[model samples]
Every structure is written in structure tokens, then in C-alpha cells.
Target chain A: MCKNALTEEKFRELDSYVDTLPEKHGMLISVLHRAQGIFGYLPKEVQLHVARSLNLTAAKVYGVVSFYSYFTEEPRGDHIINVCTGTACFVRGAEGILKELENHLGIKSGQTTPDGRFTIDALRCVGACGLAPVIMVDGKVYGRVKTGEVTGIVKEYAEV
Target chain B: MSAYRMHLLVCGGTGCRASESKLLAENLQALVMTAGMGREVQVVITGCFGFCEKGPIVKVLPDNVFYVEVKPSDAEEIVSEHVLKGRPVDRLLYVEPEQKGKVSSHGEMPFYKKQLRIALRNCGFINPEDIEEYISVDGYQALGKVLTEMTPEALVTLMKKSGLRGRGGGGFPTGLKWEAAARNRADVKYIICNADEGDPGAFMDRSILEGDPHSVLESMAIAGYATGARFGYIYIRAEYPLAVHRLEIAIAQAQQMGLLGERIFGTGFSFDIAIKFGAGAFVCGEETALIHSIEGERGEPTNKPPFPAESGLWGKPTCVNNVETFANVPPIILKGAEWFASIGSEKSKGTKVFALAGKINNVGLVEVPMGIRLREIIFDIGGGIRDGKKFKSVQTGGPSGGCIPASALDTPMDYENLTCIGSMMGSGGMIVLDEDDCMVNVAKFYLEFTCDESCGKCTPCRVGNKRLHEALTRITEGKGTMADLDNLKELGAIIKDTALCGLGQTSPNPVLSTMKYFWDEYLAHVVDKKCPAGVCTALLSYYILPGKCIGCTACKRVCPASCISGEVKKVHEIDQARCIKCGACLKACKFGAISKK
Candidate 1:
């Protein structure tokens, strides 16, 4: 049932980490956190491995992975571009900024580039609405960004 | 800290940090040290000062001199003029929009004058990462007092006396919920602080956790002691990395100091708290959904007759309170219940911290007494709408909230009054919409959020909100029919009455409230097929003014759709059918010839 999602080394590491957890009952969330940290994103095979270790159903693990917006099954790009679509940011022109990014990168939201260098996604709020129309390229935050600036921001991470 | 004669507090909250306030802090500290005032003067990076409009704020202590829009370059002048020569920099001082003179002290400023800070008491004051700073401001004093003196019953009774309602949209009485959980005897009960503040513009919970993590930890431990529970969980959002870091540091610091984790204050109670990260879900803001999420399951709300207080977490009695509500607890226990309850209106007591953003001039956070007029918050604290524009509406309660129009600006903003006006206190996200904002578009925006966020658990929220968003989209695209309006009102009522959780029930608030107040705007969208605020692009058509047109080929060259055609230096004509409405032609026109109607 594990399906050999990971190498023997990776599997052993995950097993040892799970062993360190104080309680085993509700450790799926913590395990998921570690999996995401290690693999960047959770694939079906990886999720199956987690379920097998935790003695949980595959359906149960998949249900959780799909429920939260944070957990993604697809492989992420090298740099993830997060555009804040919070009400505050939206009103202050996040839509146009997103459109600008889409135009510059030749990709829509939730889609990665062919080169797998960048992926653009719109978030509900990063709790930084005070700086509306905010964008986070990787973990670096850019705020008060004008529509004209989107191309420059995208160009910085463009393929050489 | 005591050796320093004066301290320069630079705001290091998310808002300020975005504007390079951390760099400013470093420059100030380095500049201060360069001047040989190393031990005498200290530079501290504090949390949000709340007035983010003129953010990257630097406040000098003792003198109470406040500076706005402070830059890293200004560090040289500030250190030389203020520290060495003992003179406040006049150019760097915060200039009141109304008054001509400098507003030095933060207290005298119009923005903070009408406000009362209880939950946000230490937000702009203390260094959030430093436990010592939180301690200096009397942080964990309440936890000590509660553990030493008050019993579970007595603390619950005191909370009941304080009349503090849940700040997390529900507005449920905090004390009553605690009493319910305390009454239900269990071998192991649970206390969960709902830091899952999913509301878009609302960052008050995040601010409290980032600014004063101890208050929430202390409050949770107090809840554990009061509710006869030994374990607690703080379900915070992972989006707030700064708050999460501070919380982890604070939790570890508390454990080391014997504030948390076994035998608190040398008492018999052994209450400990752990951090549980919420993977982005708006519905999880609901208590039942939150409980399910913590259980490592899909976050969806179930029918609640046997509420979380009766049976929660692992089928044991549990108490869940909002972050702001928990933040208020430590203060309530520190000061008497009467003192906490004395402020605000008759029904609602104490203060509410709002993440005031959007068209407001002062776009940050503000804590004001309940029952305070909307006019006061909008005009006084918020510094009125941005660019001196006419106030359109203020949306409260996130997606679950309705808009309060400019006509009702004078209305009191307590829970009951807000509900009466088809709005709620919501997690205190008072996003001010200006005349530039289209009400139809605004309603559509909120509906779109709820529709995407609705956990498909119930038919009403899942299908109903989706249909509502579809209808709004049709209207915005200038294809709405008269029947759509009727369908909206009817469906909104159904969703409100039948939805399983609090989130689903209030999902239609934006639709209902917008239609109620801005009826004419909706009618305009349906009948005239025109978005009054020029927000809807489908309703807009680009036309060239013959009189102003200089036959510039710029319009034709830039037009991606190849719809614009005319000779060079002549009037360009755009084919209505062929036009993509991308606005490239309009932007290309330098003579102001192209205009969209």
C-alpha cells in the first residue's frame, strides 16, 4: 500500500520523525507539515505513505489534503508568486496587478511556467491588507505595487 | 532597558515591515551607537502603531515625540538633532491632516484620541519577540493572579460579570460559553483559542498575537484553569509567519519561566498549551469546523445541538474562544470585572479592535469602545476616506458582513445596532469603500470569496453562494435580468435560515446588505446596463472624441484587438463588435481623445 513513494533514506527519516511525536492519534497534521517541508508538495504516493505509517485510510488523508488550501498535491515551482486577493487588496486594485503578472509570465493563477521556475497564485489574505495590492514572490513581500511594476518584478525571476 | 535614558520605538509589524521599517530600526540603532549614546539610548522595534497610513512610524519615549513616514536616511538627522542636541525634528514630525502644527504625542493625535486600546494595549508599544518587554508591560500578571487566587467558578463568574462577548463574528457571550464548558464535568476537557482569523482585511487577532503573545497564552491557561481543563490548543493561521514565530518563542519562554507547562505559579493546576497551524480554510473560523481541522480532518461544520462545550475535540467538554476574546481575558482578570464592563454600550461592553483599511486615510488597526458611532471611526480615527472622497460604505464582518452606507454614518456600531442595520461587528474589519467603489462590484467580490471558501458541506452555502456569485457575475457583465434580483433576495433568506454553521448562515450578508442599501445601484446595473463607479468592464465602451483626436496612430498601434482604425493624426474609430475592451487604445491616446463610457 505504501507504493514506494520515497527512497529508503527518506522513508526512514519520516518514520523516525513520526516516532518523536508525543502522541500518535492526532499526528497526521504534524506529519503532513513535515512532508510538505521535505517534499515541497504532497503527491498521491507521498500521501499514501503517510496514511500507511499513521494507520489511516487513503481516503481520509486525501480528504484532509483537499480540504485545506495550503496543502497542494501538484509539484510547486522554484519560486511561488502569491498575490493578495483580500477585500482590502482587491479594492485597491489587486485584480489588475494579478492580470499584469499573468500577462508578463504567460501563465494564469494556480499554474506553473513550462520551465517550472515560477507559479502564481492568489491568496485570500496574508494579513497584510494594510499594504494592499501586496504580492509575495517566494517569501519576500512587495507592497503598494503599481501595475506598471509587475513586469519588472516578474523579469527579476525570469529564465536567463 | 533601565539604563537607557530614552528609547526610539520603530514599528515592526507586517505593515511597517513592508515599508522597510526594520532597516530604519537598524539605521537608528547604528546611528545612535555611532554618536556614543550607546548605553544611554536604545532603539527598539515594536509592533504596529495602528496608524499605518503614515506608517514606518518612529516614536521617541519619555518625550512622546512621534515621527511619521520615517526613512532610513532620516536616521542621521534624528540621531544628530534629537539625541545629541535634544531637539525634535520638525520635518519628521507627524503633521495632523486638520491641524497645521505638529502632533508630537500619539495620545493627542486625532486618530488615537477617540480610541480605547484594551486588546491592542501593547501592540505599538512593546517588542513582540522579547518576553522581557511583554513582562515590562505587566504581561503575565493576570495569569499569576488567576492561578494564585481565583477558582474555576469564581473566574467564570467574574467573566460573566464583565459581559465580554466573542470578538470572532459570533458575538456569543464569552462567560456563558465558559460556564457551559465548566458545568459539563469531564475527565479531560480542552480549551482552544480560535486564532483562525480568516476574514480578509481583519488582522486584529494576528496583531494581538504578534504584539502580545503572552496575553493569549495567559488567557488560554486561565481558561484551562477556569474550565477545569489541563490542555489547550491555539489554532492559528499559517499565513501569519511573524505571529507564528512570536507565538512559538513566547510559548517556549513561558514554559521556561514556569508560566506554562505543569504547576503554574506553584499551584496544583498543570495547564499547558500547544500551537496547531490552520491550513487555509475560511469555514474553519467556525468552532465546530475548527475542532474538526485540529482533529486532522476536513474542516466542515456540523449541526451543533450538543455544542463544543458539551462535547468537543475528543468527545470531551471543550471551550473555544476567539483570539481577541482571549486577549481581553488577561486584562479583565487583572483589572476588576466591573472596570472591564464599565466601558462601551448597554448590551455590548468593552472595546473592539478593527483592521481599518480600504479607502480610509489611516489604513491600519484601531481599537474603539463599543457603541461608538461609525462617523467617529470613519472620520476621526480613520482620518476620513482617502483623497477626501465621498464615503460610500464600510464593510464589516468580512464575507459574512454587510455594508453600512454613508447615509447611516451616524448610527451606533455595537453588535445589536449593526445587526439592526443589516451588518455585524464581524471580526472588526472596517474596510471603508469610497465613491469610487461600485456597490454591485463590492457585493460580487464578497460573494465570490464565500463561494470559493464554502466547504461544500451544506447545500445552502455550497450551491446557494455559488448561484449568488453567478448572478452577481452576470450583473457585473451587463447581462443580468430583473428576475435575478428577486432570486437573490429569496435565496439569501433561504441560505440564512437553513445553513448548518455560523459561516454558511451569514454567507449572504454582503448580497443582502448591498441590495438593501444600494438598491438603485443594482437597478442601474440591471436596467441601464452601466456600472456607475466604472468598475464593470463589460458595461464600458471606448469612444474617440472627434474634437480632441489628433489622428495619432498610437491608439491603432497599441490596440491588441486591431479594432481601432484611422489615418495618422486623425480621429480613430473603434469597432464596437471587434473591440476586446482591453483599454490599450484608451491608454495609448495622449490627447485625451479616447474616453470610456
Candidate 2:
């Protein structure tokens, strides 16, 4: 878990979104997504809230959220860096990029920076095999990224 | 909203993105604005047009003119001639070889004519995130019908009558599973959506979840209603964040719309979905293993027949259906079973969504009728092989599927047709292999995947697969004897016959398929000590032709193994003992100096 947990404002923001949703039987997932978007991590209290709101058990809600990798319970940094490590990317030196990113950020994939500026993660496929060595910072995709480019990319985010 | 103008639907699939589709869109936009009919023209960036070889695709609506291979430079001409002057861009249009001088609309493009698009209905049309858009297109109406009017039994009967089978492998009847769980004597029943698609190159479920997530949610709720289950769980792999995110949003929207939740449409029936993530394990796709993972175990398949329908998920009766199977439910209920039953073959009902990948041109998501011929999909729909490469074989059903050689291209794709030809439709992953791909190497690739992803619960999968991989590794390295091939076949059969679960049972498919279809490649490796496709490092040697050498020293400079010894302006010689065959020399050579033999 990142040190910077969900602030009260973020919780309120998520609550507001949840309040507007119709009380559907399958709304637990939607609630968790909203919580993750606002809080960066889904805290236990929010999970309970989601369960209560959707008329589900907290265990059930936790089970669903915990089942997928996209739902995180730890605060992420300002930038989320996802490196594609699928078959094509792996064959095209994506592992080298991951190693370089780890060295530069001093954190492994799935961990947020201590100062909370970047969260690095490895993905199976971003569905962009034509651009084998691909990385996405935020929603912008940078293709054919090399190990040499890792320093400049991380520095740009860290300095921000 | 001026009715006098046209609509240009551009394919924005990932493949098109690679072909600078974004640039095409930009140029189209600029051209539309400059024509002073911007208000009349609607340039919509739609998801995958499916005709990928001739992409980035531009489709003109109202008239429905299809344009293929639209580059950025051609954008101005398309806008100026097609949109502005109402003249077709003849040069940019897809010229069908059979059609001769005639170009066709998207529907007339043979790839889509034979196909049905039930699972992919909303994919290329709707903005995936906007609930209102989905609603306008009759998204939650099925939920409304089920909640307000239909009884659980009625819904299940509709599904059974529709003859819908699970699209995510096994081909089990969807309604039967629900009915079994409904009949089971359990206080707390559950519905599980198996979105933990672990098949290599399979993305049909993920793409559906990404493009039209609400359908899956609606289907799960429908399943919940039919089975009398209060809770639903979608066990999607952690690998698909986009699917996960979209699924979450769709659930929220459905809740907001009163389609889900307690007293849905004033009915006492209620079912809510929660997501469970599988942490990079392929075997967890099995129902028992998935249940164990949801129970926070290490995701190893357990003994069956107390089958999930009878006992599952904390020891309650649970019904598990794949994402594609659930996706077929609402439509069956809405359109009636006979409508779906009428579309597909006698045994298999409705459409199957295949992740059309590998050496084909239009590598994207495709939903075809169950009986559509492989030739139709690969040649007609996929735009043939890229750059006119001769097709070798098409590998269906991921690692578990067999390779169908070019001779079998005319075979129809259904549960029976695939299984009859030494392959099973495990999940819809169709990888087209070209002539350049070595059969031995292809088998080696699938074997390697199974080895790493095997759960190691059973000796057959864990150990037998390791042995098969070693033989393939040996064969690919040009060191295997004829005895090794015999050993490979024996071990593969053993794993298939004795393994406890589906993972082990189907682990031998790649080797079996390649051996069946590309035995010559294997013979070449063993008998001739050569890799036919120049893929195996041990059978290949990098040589510099004295005539082609420009004395660039690029190969010598980049050799990580330090085996290439050469001076400037001179031919280079590789020390084969030190060369690890990483192919750095092949990539670094500028003057075609390096050739592999």
C-alpha cells in the first residue's frame, strides 16, 4: 500500500457517484470501479459501503474486486506506467525495458513510487503487437520504447 | 442534424492505429471542415471494421461505400472527392479479386455476408462507455422484459429452446446448466461468469467486455434470476484491465437504470455481480479451480462430479458460464430461441466470436456463424495473407487446438467440424500460420506456453509437458534423434489421456497438430539437421556473403556474444562456437550481408 491513502474528499467524491447509481443487483463492480478511480485504492471501508449499497456481503464485494488486477487497494502515484510484456513485446526486448524501469524507479512492477508520482506495472498485452516494445503512461501510448529511453521518460514524470 | 450529408465510419481498431488510422481520421476531419459541409458530414471513429488488411478502413454511410488502406496522404483526396463531390475514391476502395471491376459495401464484403453479429452487435456502433447510447440501442430492455414480465422458468425455457451453447469452450448448453443449478437443493446458489480466459491469443471475451460490457452484466443477472442465485461472480483475469474497467462501469449504469438490485422491476428476484481476479494462472479457467481461487486458494483444479452445478463456491450450488456464453443469453431471451436456433447449424446454435489473429491481414475480432467455412474467414474476411504470403496452416483453439493445413481450409468451423479434424474449439483463437513459419517451431511455441502456464497439480501436465518441451527444444536445436519424435508422441498422448483436468488433457494439442500437419518440418530438423524456416538456432548458421558485404562492421559492433570478428570495409566471419544465435547480426546488418543457412 502506498503511504498516501484515500483522502476524505476523494471518499466523498466516490460516494456522490455511488449515490447516483440505481440500486441494481449487479452494481457492486461499478461501485468498486468508482472507488478505485477516486481513491486510487479500494479501502476496506469503501468495500463495505459498496456491499451495503448493492445489498451484498463485504466478502463478496472483496472477492470480486480482489479477483481482477485492475482493482487495486493501494494508492497509485500521479502517473501510471504500464509496460506491455506480451508474446510480441517479450520477444522484442520488453523485459529489458522492465528491468530499466525498475532500476530507475527503485520499485518493481505493481508498486507505486514512495513519493507517489508513478506506479509501474507489467501487462500481458496492450493489443499493440505491431509496435512491439510499447509502454503507456497515463492513456498516451508510446511505441517501440527502448531501455535507453526509460531514464528520460521516468525523469519527466518524477520531476513533475 | 442535416440529413443531406454523409457519414464516414473509420475503423479505429488497434491494427488500424498501427497503420496510422489516427492520422487518417485527422486528415479526414480537416478535409470535412474545409469542404464547408462539416455539419453535414459525420466522421465517426468506429471500433474494428474487421477488414484489417486493407485498413485503416473508411466506410461511407447512407450509400455505404467501403474504402480500404486509407493512408494519411490519401485522406485529403478521400474528403475532397468522396465526401465533398460525391465521387467514390476508386483507388482507395477494396477491389475484390472475385468482384473484378466492382467495389462493394461493408455488407457485400464476403467476410461479413455469411456472418451474424449478435455478440458483436454493439461493438462497432456504440460509444462503449456512454450508458444513454447503449440504452437508446435497446441495451437493458432484455433486463426489463425479464424482470417485469418473464418468470425464471420461462427465461430458462427460452434459452433451452434457443439452443445456445457456451462459446467459451466445452459447448455445454447454457440453459441446462442454469436449470441444473435451479433444481439443485441448496439454500444459497451462485452464478459464476468465467471471464478468466487463459487461452493464448484468445480475446473474444475480453473484446466483448471492452466494447459492450452491459450485455455480460445483463446476462449474468438473467442467469441469477433463472437459477434463484442471490450473488454472481465474474472471474476475469487481471490481465484485462480494460474489460474489468468497462464491466465495472456497465454494472454501475445498470444499477442506476434499476435493471439490477432488489425488487428489480418490482420483482422479489435479485442478483448482484462481484469480480474476482485470477493472478496469472491459466488452469484457474476450470470451474473448480476458479471457485478455489475465489475462495483464495492457489488455483489448482480439484476433482469433479460434485460438479459446480451440484456443489461449488464455499460448498453451495453454483452455475459457471463463460463470458461468451453469458453474452448469448439476453439475445436468446429477447429474440426467442427459434430465431437464434435458425441461424446456426443443427448441432451448434448461434454465432461464435473468434479473435482472428496471427499471419492474416485483418487481424481483429470476428463473429461468424457456426458453420462458416475456414476459407471464408481466412481468405474472404481476413483479406488473405499479408503481402501475398502462401498460407500454411490455421491454428484454432489456442494452444489446445490443432493446425488445419491449407487443404482443410474449406472445412466449416463448428464444434463438430473442428473436433473431427483433431482440434477442439477450446476458445475462439484462430492463428493463421504462413509458409515462413516452421511447424516444429510453431509446436515448440505452444509447448513452451503450456509448460510455463501449467498448474503442476497433476504429474501428466507438470512433468509430461516438461518432457515434451525438452524433446521439442532438442529437435529445434538440431540435436534430436528419431527416437525423440516417438517419445514426444507417446508423452503427449499420455498427458491427454490421464491428466486430471482440461489443462492437462489438451496440453498435447500443439505438438500433435504440428506433427500431423507439418511432419516434413520435423523430418527436416531430425533427418536433414536443418530448420526449414531458418528458425532453429542450432540448425542455422549466419554467414556473410563477400559480394553483399558493405564492410559496415554493424554486425561486428552489435554482436553481444563477441563472436563476429571483422575489420572495417571487410567481410565478417562468425565464430559459431561463441555465437548464441540471438539474431543481433541479422538485425544489425545494413547491406543484406548476413544470411542464415
Best by TM-score: 1
TM-score of chain A of 2: 0.88
| TM-score for chain B of all predictions | 0.97, 0.86
List TM-scores for all candidates, in order: 0.97, 0.77
Model 2: per-residue lDDT, tens digit, B1-597?
235477877766655666788788888888888878778997766655555446677888787888887788998888878777889988877676655655757777666776679988876566566677677778777888887888988888888888888887889888898899989887899999999887756667776776677888888888888888988988887656667877788788778777777777777877788777666677788889888877755577888888898999989999999988877877777788889999878899889988766676666677888888999988877778866888888888877888899988888789998988888888887878777678887787778778877877789999999999999999988889999999988888888999999878998988987888788889999999998877677898888888998788899989998999878888789998888887789988888878998
Counted clashes in each candidate structure:
4, 14
DockQ, in order, for the candidates? 0.71, 0.14
Q: What is the DockQ (computed on Cα atoms) for candidate 1?
A: 0.71
Flag regions of model 2 displaced more than 4 Å: A1-123, A129-160, B1-48, B51-60, B63-104, B146-150, B544-594
Residue-level lDDT tens digits of model 1 in B78-105? 9999988889999988888877778888
Docking class of 2: incorrect
